[model samples]
Target: MPYQVLARKWRPQTLQDMVGQEPIRRILSNALEQHRIHHAYLFTGTRGVGKTTLARILAKCLNCETGITATPCGTCSTCQAIDAGKFLDLFEIDAASRTKVEDTRELLENVPYPPVQGRYKIYLIDEVHMLSNHSFNALLKTLEEPPQHVKFLLATTEPKRLPITILSRCLQFHLKPIPLELISDHLHYICKQEQVTADKTALNYLSKAANGSLRDAMSLLDQAIAYGQGSIKSDDIHAMLGTIAQQNLFPLMKALAAQDSNQVFHAIHLLAEHTPDFSNVLEELISLFHQIAVSQVITYQQKTDQQITELAALFKPEDVQLYYQIALLGRRDLAYTPSPQQGFEMTMLRMLALQPKQMVVQVETPTLTVAESPSWQEILPKLDLSGMAYALAANCTLEKIEDHKVILQLSANHQPMLNTKLKDRLRESLSNYFKQAMQLDIIITAAELYTPAKKQEQEQVERLTDATKAATQHPKIKQLIEMYDATIEVSLL
Candidate 1:
């Protein structure tokens, strides 16, 4: 006969044959057994997650000669006809193509009629969201109240675009994305059945490349098998996908973790030859970091001989989190740049920039000795924002008493629960060696916590108003006003 792809050839023939959708299958099975049949149903989920497949299977379950059942015998004539796409009663529609109101009106007009030839008539509309508004309106009444023999199975990846009126009428069943582990196992099954020798690692890579889509994975595996001839390997799969070799990323990650600037730059340069998508490289690092993180959490007994053992030893969990943050920022900056390569380089630099500052600044300043006073003069001007924040917590404000510790007013608001979680995190995150501790004393002042309108900037603007008013009347200003017939929209000092 004709050449058959693995996805179609190994398609699930029964509920038992289906993979990675236990919840949906279990629900449908129970519904069938209990005879809790709904007139019309909507199946929603991402592409290649068995939405269409389930619709087809459900069609067989409804019309099989064995009677209405979830586990329809695939050997039966009705089941075979449905499986081979030759069933007259099971009318499969790609709403994406037949989305006009006239088409919907014409087709749905038959919903009132009983099944023709088969026990039940099944209408499977794939990409149901693509139906036009008018078409959906035409379908609404029929779908809500179809004849006893008619079953409408609507499927769409984008369910949000579907109107509530249509959605409300149908019994919705969401077909979820298959898991990665399940996809990998499915690929292995396909390979063995195809009589192809393939490395398990290659299948794992294909599973990931599929991104939770079984149809995509099978299509990819078909191409990989053809490319590998009699045997399939990870290297061949990687090349076929235009994916960068894992080692190309491994050394780069190693250098970044080591804070080896030279080696990191060299690795970035080498990536140019492969023409690797820089964003993909960052994503690879994230995945690697995730692996290392889970590895660190593994107990002694759980440390079986695995490939990630070395990675667990090489990086700390905290370092993994840090690198992930840097890589995330780099990826976010990709769109704003003029050149993708420069964006790529900037990402590298950003990842490297997390290395702790090495420079030490030494400054000498004269000290001032102040006489003892009943109350200290608060020197708020020289205090940095962080320092000011600390002083605000203490009852008394700190004075710049020649860089020595000054007092700040403290209140009950500084108590743990009263203080916001954000402030506590900021307090805990100080340089480990030696950061100034803010001290508190009770000072009666009318000052409130800094507000935007009360910020030093706005305060300065308020002060400059008088000066600006004075300058507005200058003789030179008058002369300029007359010369250009100009009024000062803004007067600059």
Candidate 2:
């Protein structure tokens, strides 16, 4: 016999075998027992989450020889035929493959008739959202008012694309991704069944990579089994998945935490030789920072006398936030840069540069100065526009200005789509620079969209931003960010 792949071999043969979808199972099983069946059912979920599989199981339950029983005896001819995909009453349609008005009409043509063998004719349409708008409308009528003998099972990753009228007519159940622990248990079970030897550490990595997909995790495990040739190792899994092991990531972190750029750069060059994924490195680094943050909090809760004192000295919250931002922006820019090494070096340098400059170690903590919130004057300069454009942006109705103090009234309604937090942040930035006092009051009220007189003006703004970005390399500008930091975002408006 030919060897079957894990995904196919481990496919849930019955509803009881399916994992991570207890609510749907209970509902469907009870519906079968009570005979309270709906004419149309919709199953929606991400890929590898068993939406289609559940649909198939439901079809079997509906058309079994034992007469609509939830648990169909596999020995029965009706259940056997359905399992083999040869059941006359069951028609599985890939809406993606046959997505046309004519195809939908043709399929529905047989729907009006009674089932040839079973009690009901089941139409399972997978990826139903892929159907064209016209095909969806064509099927909507039948699904909304189908013949009593017919049942429609529509499965899709995206249900929003389907018209509300179509959605309202069906009973929708969303299948969730299987949990990691569940996938891990299933993999161990499958390995035992297949007589395959595996390591727990290898399985843990595979579990995370699967991202809550049983089929994907099983497939990975299957590949590992073949690669291991009867033995599984975490090292093999790491190489297969392009992951840098914890040992590799930890040293890189020490270099970063110590702000040792020379060692960090050397390590990066070594990493580049192996073509280490800078994106993943950045991700792992951020995760480590988060771990450190948690550790810092845990250190604080120590009822011991030295605990709270030590926690206060843990990596300052401000510095942790800075490194996170640096790593995040580094990851985003890594995609556009010429090479990963350059992006890696730049991110490290950014953190080092942000280290607080020496301040003569004042004997007493500096008096806390009350800095006013940001105001329009301070913000206009950062807008990256000049002359006329800058003036127009600053004039954002300079409602009031007195001796370095200013009140700029915004057309609150002008850009209703502007994020509320973003608007307030920008407002505070402007107020801080515009005043020597406490804060510049920002009152946002609905305003209308500003109709630019010339379309070219908006075009010029976009062109200017592109030109500015081209002139300023991300890392170079990143160099200027430090303890008190704010990122510049260019808006087309």
Candidate 3:
């Protein structure tokens, strides 16, 4: 037998063998078991997501010699014929090539006839959206009211181009892109069955490159196997796909975290030597920033790499967010640059230039006795807080400190900020500031209290009133006001 590619060799024969697409698989299985088959079915999704492949499986299920079943026996002649693409009843049409109204009419002419071989005459149209408007108009009537012996299976990557009349008449199933982990696992399983030596990291890289398409992943695996001479390695896969190793990105991230310009350029110089796809490098950096931000915000049960943990601890949450946005913009603008490496270098430089400089200050820790407890307003600025935690702290007034518990009264208006995460963060910040373990009790009160936020508001109002009064009394202002018949507006001031 001639050499068959991995994608063709591993083509799923039964519905159960199909990877991913659990929902659609389940639905089709139930429909088959119940014998509630529809006349026309439409499968829509991106390329290589098993749209046409699913249609073929459905055809087999309907035409199998063992009778209609979700689990078709691949050995039966009918199943074998369908699999071999020699089934008389299965009319596989590529709408891209035969898209004229005449071609459509000619095809629909056979719909009224009964099956010559299989139980039902199945029409599997691939790239059905490529059919012209006139062709779709010709297919509409026959599609809506096909014979009991006929089943229409239409698959398309672009379903929007399909007319609503055609879409409404058919039972549509949108197949989602296969997830990365699922694709990777499927590749691993295939490697085991094929007796091929492969690295797990290499499979992961291929899976990401596939972007949720199992067929594409399999094709890439075939190329990878050939490239590695029957074995797969991560470095070989990286070279094949023009992607860099995950470790290559860590050095740049570490440099950025440390704000070391020389080290940043050095890291970039080393990375450029690999001649990586800089756009992909930017994407990797963006992904790393996102991971770091997630790590900073939440505790993870999974064991993270020591480098990621260290980077997360070194960089602030806000800094991660800023870097993520900058990397995203950099990736988007990479194509317009003179060269990809220059674009990548500029993006790194931009991150350093725009990042807020951290100021180091040394202050002696003051011991506070219960009798000498500081005002809540004074403590608010000292606590390490940002985002919702800072907002929650600013709107709270210290009630009392009993033992290690710090009681706070929160304004009822800002009650929405009192989630467990924010509350725990506030408690942690307070504990850190006081140089001792502390517990927090926040009571929401509708009654107004002098919170730090309210105090600041009052001081701002007083200053504005003083400024307006001073402006109204000024000689130049009074003369201009009288000349223009204008009254002083504090808001304008």
Model 3 residue pairs with clashes? none
* TM-score ranking, best first: 3, 1, 2
Per-residue lDDT over 1-493 for candidate 1, one digit per residue giving the tens place of the 0 to 100 score: 9989888887887787888889889999999988898988888888888888888888988888888899998888888889889998988999999989999988887777777679888889989999999998888878766777888899999989999999898889887778999999988888888799999988888999899899999899889988999689987877777666566677777777788889988888887677766667767766777777877886766744365667567776766776666667667877888866788777678667644332222222223333323332323322232453444432233333323233333333433322444344333332111255432323334555332213434545654564445445666666545533445543323
Per-residue error (Å), model 1, residue 295: 3.5
Highest TM-score scorer? 3
TM-score of every candidate relative to the true structure = 0.70, 0.69, 0.73
Candidate 3: stretches off by over 4 Å? 357-493
Question: Which regions of candidate 1 deviate over 4 angstroms?
Answer: 245-248, 269-275, 297-301, 304-309, 312-318, 335-342, 356-493
Decide which is better by TM-score, 1 or 2: 1
lDDT of 1 at 489: 41
Candidate 2 displacement at residue 434 in angstroms = 40
The residue-by-residue lDDT of candidate 3 on 33-103, one tens digit each, is 99999999999999898888899999999999999999999999999999999999999999999989999
User: How well does model 1 score by local distance difference test?
Assistant: 0.72
Candidate 2: residue 491 Cα off by (Å): 28
What local lDDT does model 3 show for residue 60?
A: 93
All models: lDDT? 0.72, 0.73, 0.87
